[model samples]
Target: MRKYLILGILLLGSMFSYANVSIRSMETELVAVGISHESIKEAENILNIALKKHRIMLIELEQKELEVNKLLIEDPEKNWFQINRLLDEIGQINANIKKNQLKAQIDVRKFISKDDFLKAIELHQMNLGVIK
Candidate 1:
């Protein structure tokens, strides 16, 4: 369990590092593809706000997950109820993160053109090597 938690933390750390790069790459690609300055700025503002909120939620989620792991390691039998409660909180945070991401995407789509938005997505995937 400890090993799993350490691995999860490492994976999440790497993902967060990649997320920062990905956001900047997307912004640069949007400009390179001739997306309007106004649209880019608007989309960037929306995304930044969402990203800020997401970072908070992710930190909370990570802390709660760590707490649960601690409880489990210390005394799974004695801390059963607390462990379950923390697990529930983690689930709720995960759900909220998903909802927040969807809302941000919808908000961004309103400010950016469909074609431009798709182009940015394609460029992002290409950067990740997800597309040939």
Candidate 2:
């Protein structure tokens, strides 16, 4: 019984880990769109630099959320007030992640043609279907 419980926990953890990928897959999408390898490398390099700040913020956000969850679990009554604040923080983090993603998209687009960008979008949609 304990082994089964541990397996279930590990499976769920792996699922969540896959859910968080954004940048790496996008790079592959670039290659799928027939983007030049040199261009992809250059664009990815620039985008990666731009993403470092946003990535740090996201990491901090994740840490804070985990801490908040831990607090709520350990002491439900006292942690009630923290819920609203944490929710707000989470909302802000989500918005910032979106913003950063948009910025990265634009940065990569600058290195590729408009047609390639459109192709990438189509490929991304197809990948969503296939991945699920």
Candidate 3:
């Protein structure tokens, strides 16, 4: 979880730095590409909900990280047990975040056809410099 969390946070943090993409922009592109309005709307709704959940979880994680950091700073060598308990809480929070993110992706996919998904991926790659 720690390994993935490192990667995930890095990706999430740097995502906006790489592109000005938003769910609304994707919705517009989907509509422009002839995807049905209803399908695009549904997908956008799912994405928005997922993003909100992800944001909340990120804030929670940051708060928990601060608590852990403070504990380490205050006790340094005498809070091993409390530090472990905080680590367990962090683990649980990360698991919940992973679950919510996956569920959101699953729900979004239900409304987007395979070709549309591919197009979105391609656009993402182009915007994020994955493809030059």
Q: Please give the CA lDDT of all the candidate structures.
A: 0.74, 0.65, 0.71
Q: Best candidate, lDDT-wise?
A: 1
Misplaced by over 4 Å in model 1 are 1-35, 119-132
TM-score for all models, in order of appearance? 0.67, 0.52, 0.70
Can you write out model 1's per-residue Cα lDDT over 71-116, one digit (the tens) per residue?
9899999999999899899879878877877787788777676787
lDDT of 2 at 114: 72
Q: Number of clashing pairs, model 2?
A: 0
Error of 3 at 79 (Å): 2.3
How high is the lDDT of residue 62 in model 3? 79
Which prediction has more favorable lDDT, 2 or 3? Answer: 3
Q: Assess candidate 3 and give its TM-score to the true structure.
A: 0.70
- Model 3 clash pairs are none
Please write out the lDDT profile of model 3 over residues 23-122, one tens digit for every residue: 4566555665567879877866776676677677788887887888898899967888888888898888888877876776677668776688678767
